[model samples]
Target: MALFVETGLKPLSANESYLGKKTKSKAYRMYENHLLRVLPDLPLEPKGKMKLTAEVYYSNKLSDLDNALKPFIDCLQKRYLFNDNRIYKLEVEKFIVEKGAETILFRLDPYSQEGDKDYVPHPTDDREHRCPECGHSF
Candidate 1:
């Protein structure tokens, strides 16, 4: 099932820094509070590898795509009692919309690589590959 949240809140970057202290920003705190009131109860506990697809509607086009993932994923991890490490595949897209129309749509699904013929290797996978032309391993 897909979840939709319309909080009129701007996306907060996880990289926000303050005085060399490690902490969540005020925007993130407000976003979390808003999520607590709007998020629905799940019927089952999510386990194993998972896939997350997020569609973020922002008021402007200047926001970086990568900056939006951390805050939202952190909240989902807290709410669902699951580790973000379990997410094997993540897909995020952002759209520019009018102010006050900012929203986020999320879909979480169980995923497994077993018996899949067309699976692409993740960049962080430990396996080494040999260059076909140079005969070098990277």
Candidate 2:
């Protein structure tokens, strides 16, 4: 699925980058609210690993990809789009949009572990138990 938001809001600064900045500016607060409002309702517990991709179309070429994506991706965590740790892969791309039109497109998909030999389920899985003592498998 995809969610779209208007472009041009700046991202939050990385931790402690600017020393002694005691307060969040109004613009930052507004940006946070806007992201929350635009984010779609995501599953509280994803079925499996997830892949998130964002396509940022900006009128200005100077916008940094990581800076543009941080606020939105972080909001996904707050809104339960899936934990950042569960993400198997992440993709972000930027494109120059027409002078007057710029927008951000967010897409997400669940990835199943079926057929994957390296898959190791979480401890909470209750599907079945194997008999280690006997030569039996469940």
lDDT of 2 by residue, 20-58 (tens): 755756987787788778777755445667778789888
**Residue 12, candidate 1: alpha-carbon lDDT:** 58
Over 4 Å off, model 1: 1-20, 44-46, 115-118, 122-138
For each candidate in turn, give its C-alpha RMSD to the true structure in angstroms.
10.4, 14.1
Q: CA lDDT of each candidate?
A: 0.77, 0.69
Candidate 2, position 5, lDDT? 40
| TM-score, every prediction | 0.68, 0.57
lDDT of each residue in 1-138, candidate 1, tens digit only: 334433333455444544466776798899998887788876534568887889999997998887778788888888878898899787788999999998889988887777445465543548766666665665
Q: lDDT score, residue 138, model 1?
A: 55
Question: Deviation in angstroms for 64 in model 1?
Answer: 0.6
